[model samples]
Target chain A: MTGSSVLFDAPGPKARRNSLITSIVGGALIVAGVVWMAMTLAAPRESGGITLPGMFDESRWDIFADPELWGFIWNGVIGTLRAAAVAAVFALILGVVFSLLRSSRLKWVRYPTAVVIEFFRGMPVLLMMLFILLVFSTGSYWAVVSALAVYNGALIGEALRAGLAALPRGQREAGLSLGMRELQTKLLIEFPQAFRQMLPIIVAQLVVLLKDTSLGYIVGYPELLRATMNNLSSYYGNRYLFPLFVVTFLIYLTMNLLLSWLARSLARRRNSGGGGRGRRNAGGDADVSPDQAILVAEASAAARRSTST
Target chain B: MDVVIDNLPLYLQGFGVTLLLLAVGGVGALVIGVLIATMRIAPVASLRWFATVYTEIIRNTPLTLVFIFCAFVLPYLGADIPYLVSAFIALGVYTSPFVAEALRSGINGVPVGQAEAARSIGLGFGQSVSLVIFPQAFRMTIPPLINVFIALTKNTSVAGGFFVAELFATGRTLANANGSAVIPILLGVAFFYLLITVPLGLFAGRLEAKWAVAR
Candidate 1:
């Protein structure tokens, strides 16, 4: 839906005047906030500020000129991508497995799978990582990868389950009428359809998983945030902390924005490509994030459950 | 079992801190979120731009980096906040964008006819939104808002790494001290986290079912 336009009318003459006044005021406030932040950053350390030589001072930024520092950061970038790639693969595989199990006809299979999914989803990723490291004595990298995989797998499984539930009953019925067993229908027909419908959401979840790999810092994995904030800052001294943070922040923002744009574009294509299919999946819009999609899915699923019971 | 039994007080203390963070952070996020959501819909062009930019930046950034900024950069910039206070700010600011997105979608879910009706009655924009739209919007929002808080509950763990002695931090400390009981210690931590998240999930489900607005 086109946002906000539905909430109010097009501005009349008097309303236009007031809108202009508020716009000016808002612009001034934003400028004032930025200027104040700059002044604070330029203040002395004796006043509890960061500017020993000033935040904008050339000496503070001169560290970037060093090629060795760039090499260090490149390693960090690779490290973060490596862990995310491996974790994403495992998480997708585990997600498919969990979703299949969750859709099983047997109560025994479904019940325990539900409990396991809930358990993984409920626990904090960092706690799980630390637990894996301490209990199993896996290296820090494995701990981070495994925890992310399991947690995101549970979420992805739920998203897929939602997609499965949203599918038209005819798809499944037709498969069964063709003499296909439940498992075969789900695998060959239903699951592929669900996967296609949920592709945007799965990609959105991967973006989240990528952002979460920064938690590898706590587990002592050499991810981007740790490489910059922990390792680089220590190596370059505390004077460069703000500069390092700015660089790290930009890198992450760029990567995640690109991924989010990809998800939205995929949603847009899906919406435009298959007209009737798009309308059937509730909240499967270009703007919905993975979390929101899952929430919508769960809400509908809950409604379905209550009505059936 | 004995390890967990003996360290029950430590576990309780950590659980309390986690709950406190959740409550404080949840309130902070809701307040900021509502304000941002309002700005996004406001007639002022600059306000809408500001809100959109803020939401995008926060949504794309990791919670860990947000924590680092709150815990380190704020102090470096002369904001003498404590670790716990910083943790609260980090969680609130990091989660606010999601809250705003949910609220905006809720507002979108309100029927366009309602707004037209409000306008026909000579109601101004603010009056239409507050009196007519928001009340309806909030009904559609409760389930998703609850889901956001459930996420906030798990996010509190990131604060532990930033020096707040929350549940995950306590788990780390206890695990280091009693390495042999690592399994039980981590399990205890997981149990406490589940105590918060599971109930919230169930409550959200119930609310969704009960408040299934057929629009």
Candidate 2:
């Protein structure tokens, strides 16, 4: 039952045999694909194949050991991280503001905030980057950061709103019963609890915001991808593009995986009753389970009426 | 603003290219995604592993790398596919994992009791999934599927990096032609994208509402 799919019962003897046959067939298909790709790459250069293994050549590989190239690549990575950090901060601030506005009592405030979120969510981050860059006269740094900030700000806002909406109405009633003002009750009681639920979702959106920094390359922002491309052309000409692209891809994969691991570990610690040190002492919402945290995040994203690119 | 009107035809062409990629890529992703989702749930351990690996790798890698691979790696390997074909392939392959994950979640949401009941009626594994599970799953899938499609539509802009004359590229050219009017040109491009995404987004919301009550 532990390994079983939710939709299937355990397999019987005959089903085991069928599974073996399918696995063999699947393995063959994968091998065939790899063989085809290798043959294509190993073909003659005049006939459009690289014909040379310049990518694996010691000379080309040595370029990576060069201090100048390494320095440039490091700078690009820092640029990407810096932009993402700034954008995440801005997005969180904006998300909190809009989500608060969304639940506002006034129609003018609520409706207009909804419209802005919808618009930002629908527009591509790349388009937003271009628009912001041109319209605001901000350089590439702000352009990239602002675009990511606005787009993700909308997503985080929706997630936070959903978190608030999912809370038991009695919590609000209890706060009011204590003679607290509505705004005070919300500010002191509601938002803190909602935020505890929203943390995982915010982290997920932050991963997305990080990946989007690669788009900064299109505008010559000297991010990781752009820096790698520059190094590729400068050092080995266009011939070594594939290897460099693979390297860049792996770096991104590693970063995203680290973020995911952080999410998982945080969830684990909370679920194990480790009394995770940062567990908020406020509002007695201290028992926010990790599973419930993720579920609310996903549900909120699903419940979001607005769509994003 | 006048620049937008003057270059309306150019913008329209770019818009057409974006739609073309979206239509073709959407179909390709749906087919592959369903196949991968089937593989994921299949009783074969190796096949399930394969599907898991594929999804993990593709979803983690950025779409830009996929585009670069299609644009350059294929040529390096002695294939000379057209720019549009390569771009479409990249878009389809990059997006399929997301589509598959959505469909898989949809599949999960259907009760095990439903599948067991289907099997009791003498349906095979494939038949149960296709006839009973998928129909129910797709309804649950529509909203998330729409989100994936919207992401795909926006991602098509990356084709501009590889020299496909899509909306963003059109905007770039317009900006270059009238440097001071960059604002209008970008506004026009963003408007064109909204023309496609905004309506589809609204429709998805309506559909989600329609389906929520049924669920």
Candidate 3:
């Protein structure tokens, strides 16, 4: 509160408390409405001549238990994971490569990489998928991987660029003063710092990409969604909702948990190792003094005052 | 490639269906998205729980599964919703969670002090949100919202599986009818999609840049 935030002007303690209450109240009302509606409303019924009990099935937990479904799902999951993982690797490589290119003294390599990154970053993931699908058809696994790699690779470029920008100008000057090559400055000093800062955001984007593998089903690839469709058509058409809800919860929960854990571990290591600027900032003085915090809040509030004509 | 030109009229029909589905589903999802966003951010404990469950349940599932469930199920209870409406319902619901997340994040981006100032100006609780917070939120949220919209537009191809006859279906139909030309036909479909998504992406970028400069 002592310093100005990027957004809103600051407020006094009472004002902050009041707004927190309104946020709480507004959120509460929404939850209440959803519950009232869901409980009062009936589960949607199937339109066919027959009705099935609308509940999640456990017996077909064996469907997952089945080697065939398991193989397919496993393969699908592996393919998805491998694609995302490989793409992530490629993205990292590409991001680092592009950052070095831009940071280099020569303009030749820098501008092309910049343009390529911007074009792909500006387009949607689906467009990338479609463009790749055109070459690969339904059977080409490499095509999907390539498409994901290139597009995500582009995004990593931007993340790296931003991360580099976050570094203080003094660091770059010090590296140059020490007679380091531009590449040495970037790789030895700049990148390690930027990568640490950008890791959380990059991870979040990767999770989105992981979820996006399901989009492959549109091109007739037999991924998890395809498996779900196969099961629904063969066994329990009328009970699609419950089964869908369960399967989605299970699969996504496990994957997201794993990803989150990896992210946490990475963050933890960086913090413990005293690897970057964050470590310097992590000293005991990092704690905000309440009085100064209040003053900052007051100052922040003062900015909110609009001077009317 | 030859198939596309020969069947130009039919492919145009398919493009029309694709556009219609996106428009209807996009609008429907926007309503559902806004509602769920409010729910997720609600103040009540129990109420917030419901929104959490909804987002958790919906966001995790594959969009394709939801679409299939809508297509294959719900017929046993004496209801026969049209394939288009069914597709819309599933896609709309699937996209809503994303939109909700985008919006909630955007709204959260607005500084809390703004809310305080609005209240000090004598705006009531809801008034502060609807008038002060949301305008800023909408401005911030446009970029992500555009990204979601582009994804949703592409996802409509999923309904092609249920035989809804959208652009993808038309491409597939053309592929089937004029064998070995799937590549060009899909390229045709992709062309239509790019024609739509690119402009929208640029528009959203403009909106974001404008808001960024404003703030």
User: Where does candidate 2 stray beyond 4 Å?
Assistant: A1-9, A35-51, A54-60, A266-309, B111-135, B213-215
- Per-residue lDDT, model 1, residue A115, is 96
| Evaluation by DockQ, superior candidate among 2 and 3 | 2
What is the CAPRI rating of model 2's predicted complex?
acceptable
Candidate 2 lDDT over residue span B109-183, tens digit each: 666677877888888768887898878767667777887887788888888878899888899888878988888
Ranking by DockQ: 1, 2, 3
Clashing pairs in 1: none
DockQ of each: 0.46, 0.38, 0.16
Tens-digit lDDT string for candidate 1 (B43-160): 7899999999998898889889999999997787668899999999998898888888877767666667788888888988799889988887787688778878878888999999
Question: What proportion of the true contacts does each candidate reproduce?
Answer: 0.45, 0.37, 0.10
Residue-by-residue lDDT tens digits, candidate 3, A127-236: 45655665455353555566666766665666666567546656677798999987788888888877776675566556655666666666555556555556443554
Task: Give every candidate's TM-score on chain A.
Answer: 0.87, 0.82, 0.68
Per-residue accuracy of model 1 over A117-200 as CA lDDT, tens digit each: 989887888888998888888999999899989988988898788787667666788899999998899999889888977888
Interface RMSD per candidate: 8.0, 5.5, 12.7
TM-scores for every candidate against the unseen true structure = 0.91, 0.87, 0.71
